[model samples]
Target: MGLVVSHLSIDCTDPNALAGWWAEVLGWERAWDEDPDDDEVGIRAADRSAEWLFLKVPEAKAVKNRLHPDLRPPDGSDQATELARLLALGATPVDIGQGPEVLWHVLADPEGNEFCLLLRTPAQVRADGD
Candidate 1:
């Protein structure tokens, strides 16, 4: 049998809060089994398809993240609107050496982990028109 990616994991100072923030951002729900005081917390899509696991770590973030989630605009919104909404949710813009021609916005979560927000694809733009 082949392996499949069941979840994406994030390491952070506060797993519970990070998990909650991500859940709000993605419109996903917390995995009912997780507790606010747990070192590990999980969130997943309504269908439980995109599972995300957040783990607490002892060391603070010292450098750039090696891996991070790249978020895409949902069905009806455009990238700029989504970016503004995320900023309101406490995501701050981060400079990761992206040039003027770069097609995505680099942002950091409250704990300073870097992630990208890509511009909407053609299909997503079409969805906006619908």
Candidate 2:
């Protein structure tokens, strides 16, 4: 049988904090039995099919992420609304040479991990016949 995909791990200075931040961003919850001071922390997706694991590391993030998550707004939410909300939640805009004309916005979390907010929500994509 083929191997199954598990969690996506991220290295950060403070796993608990970063994981909490991401949980807020994704509307996920902290994994069961994970404490605020743990060196490794995790958040589970609403449906529990996916997880993001965060591990503590000594060095700060020094370079752009080679692998990053691309996020889409949920139903009833559009890209501009989501961008505004993320900015309010402490996510900052990032410039990764994705010039002005691109359809998505690049953003960095509080710990400097880069992720993208795509231009269209799933509802929009469906409406556009994409």
Q: Give each model's whole-structure lDDT.
A: 0.88, 0.93
Per-prediction TM-score, please? 0.89, 0.93
Superposed by TM-score, candidate 1 places the C-alpha of residue 122 at a distance from the truth, in angstroms, of 7.1
Best by lDDT: 2
lDDT string for model 2 (50-118, tens) is 999999989999999999999999998889999999999999999999999999999999999999999
Summarize candidate 1's per-residue lDDT along 1-130 as a digit string, tens digits.
9999988888888998889898899999998676768998989999977898888999889899999888888867889998999999999999988877888999999999999999985587677894
Worst 10 residues of 2 by lDDT: 30-39
Q: At residue 72, give the lDDT of candidate 2.
A: 98
- Local error of candidate 1 at 115, Å? 0.8
Residue 24's lDDT within candidate 1 is 90
